[model samples]
Target: MTAAQPFVQEGPDWPGLRIFATTRAGGVSAAPYASFNLGAHVGDAPGAVAANRARLRALLPSDPLWLDQVHGTRVADADHEADPAPADAAVTRVPGRVLAIMTADCLPVVIAAPEAGVLAVAHAGWRGLAGGVLENAVAAMGVPPDAGLRAWIGPAIGPLAFEVGDEVRAAFARAAEPPAGAFVPTGGHDAAGAPKWLADLPALAEQRLRAAGVATVVRSNLCTVAGNDRFYSYRKEGVTGRFATLAWLVP
Candidate 1:
């Protein structure tokens, strides 16, 4: 692992699995995107994104299955080669085929069921969360109902910084009925004096994962907006790069 190009390794509860979350540090990209922008669609130079990806590829067995994430709940099975599909999540039972999700503020989730020989990752923004991206990914893994699945919630806009309108709050409440603590009404209000609530994305994700039969769930406790020095933040910085969370079976 490159010490300067920061990445956090996920715990080893699921055997035969390797997962990592990269930070904004260490790459060839210049300003705005800066040194280590992994996302190519976010206005970063092609050469810079290529260089950054090539640098990241050194840590994995193969190139990652990059998705054209549309903030929806579609899931792609990464067992075969295909064009970047329109999906928010991906899964694979094949060893060494890396599943990657790029994000700045949206939560990146990595799921593994080593006993079942399956692994998956999702790009879960609020929209994807409300629409069941996590559930879809779990289903796509093809794990039996009795299978033990675990997940790690990666960096995103944290609760304190994620201000939202009543509609956003209502969406989660109406659909999943997540815990009250997941949606905290804050002092901040929009122009119409409508109260802005602080929504805990990780908390909501945990609830959904549990509902979808995941046995264990762990959160990274890293916030892209707050940990700006380490991760990129589209919400905090309008024009920014995207870091990635990658998971695969250890060969």
Candidate 2:
């Protein structure tokens, strides 16, 4: 019952590189993740999804090097690779090639070393974030730990709407206790009522980036859960599609 939004941004915050995130708009995908289903592993019609990708590719530097996106810290060398690789993040120094990450609720992060001509994309789904995905990606860039890197977060489940179980809280506790604030206890109750917790994924990611030697970070105020009409949220729908967030250098 809602109208479609457009695929756009005011402008990329990453200088010397092209960076963009896909919205849940302007595509052929129908129903759940209607239009612009950038995720291939999510069970959408391959033909339709490919068509949507083709449409999206028309606006980028080149076909994006997609990832399998396991919730791990593995980083892929997609700089010149032509196929999808099993990794949580991707990095490239080659010009005209794109590195991308997709998510519905999980945070999609874009990293760039403009001076170093390095660009990367990561899927930070708490597991990946806590497991050192950002650190891995930046380290893989070979830019030296002191070389300042910049980053930006794409739309994902915001803190106000993201609730988690004790186990989830425990995961963050193992990584960094300070980020515990990203999670708010729901109160002691059952699984349905047991104290759930709200998570601020962006804040958690920023902390990781800062700790990883990244100095500049830009963030979008978009929340996938609250902006379903503009984003593709798997949590919002039982079987929804995916949108894309990409970054690349122009030849």
Candidate 3:
């Protein structure tokens, strides 16, 4: 990893597994998508995106299966699927098959059940969370009763920076009541005067992962909105590049 290396390698020290989150630090892109932007659909130059991806590819064992995330609860089978597809999450039991999710402010979650030889990644925004993206990913992993899974929640909009409306709160309630303190009233309102609250995205993700039987859930606690210099932030900049969070089992 050099000063120009784009990834911030972090995750469990488990054997035969590799995980990391990319930063918008080194690449050929310019301006709003300034350098290291991996998302091809975010309006960055196709060639620049490709060049950046090539840089990332050099560091991996195989090409990553990048999903066309739609903020929905669809988990792809990376072991079988060879091409990029429309899904917010992907799981694979095959070693060396990399799974990647691109996000600016949305949560990027990496999950691994080494004993079961399963690895998964998810792109969870509020909508994805309410729609059970995390739950679906964990279910897809199919870890044995005693195998146990551990997850690492990556950079996303922090609690204090992610303001939401009643509908957002209600969405969680309808899906599965969030743990207390997940949403704190901000005592503010949108243009329509609708009540606003600061939602803890990481907390919400941890709650869902635990409910789905993950044994250990760790958070990076890195805020994209706050640390805009290192990570991209769609909420802070409507037109911005996306960073990637990836996971794979060593071959």
TM-score of each: 0.93, 0.91, 0.94
Off by over 4 Å in 2: 1-6, 191-194
48-142 per-residue lDDT for model 1 (tens digits): 89888988998889989999999999998788646756999988988899889999899999888888889989999999999999999998888
Q: TM-score winner between 1 and 2, please give it.
A: 1
Q: How does candidate 1 score on lDDT?
A: 0.86
Candidate 3 lDDT over 1-251, as tens digits, reads 45366657476677778988888887888989998999888888999999999999988888989888999999999988887568999999999988999998999999889878899999999999888999999989887646778999998899889989989999988868888899999998888988899999999999898888888899988998874578989889999998899889988
Residue 113, candidate 2: how far off, in angstroms? 1.0
Instruction: Please provide, for model 2 over 115-156, each residue's C-alpha lDDT reduced to its tens digit, 9 standing for 90 to 100.
Output: 888888899998888888999988888897666688888888
Q: What lDDT score belongs to each candidate, Candidate 1 first?
A: 0.86, 0.80, 0.88
Best first by TM-score, ranked: 3, 1, 2
Model 1 TM-score, all chains together: 0.93
Backbone clashes in model 1: 0
Q: Candidate 1 — which residues are off by over 4 angstroms? A: 1-13
Name the 10 consecutive residues with the lowest summed lDDT in model 1.
2-11
- Cα RMSD of all models vs. native, in order, equals 2.2, 3.1, 2.0
Please report, as a residue range, the 10-residue window in candidate 2 with the lowest summed lDDT. 2-11
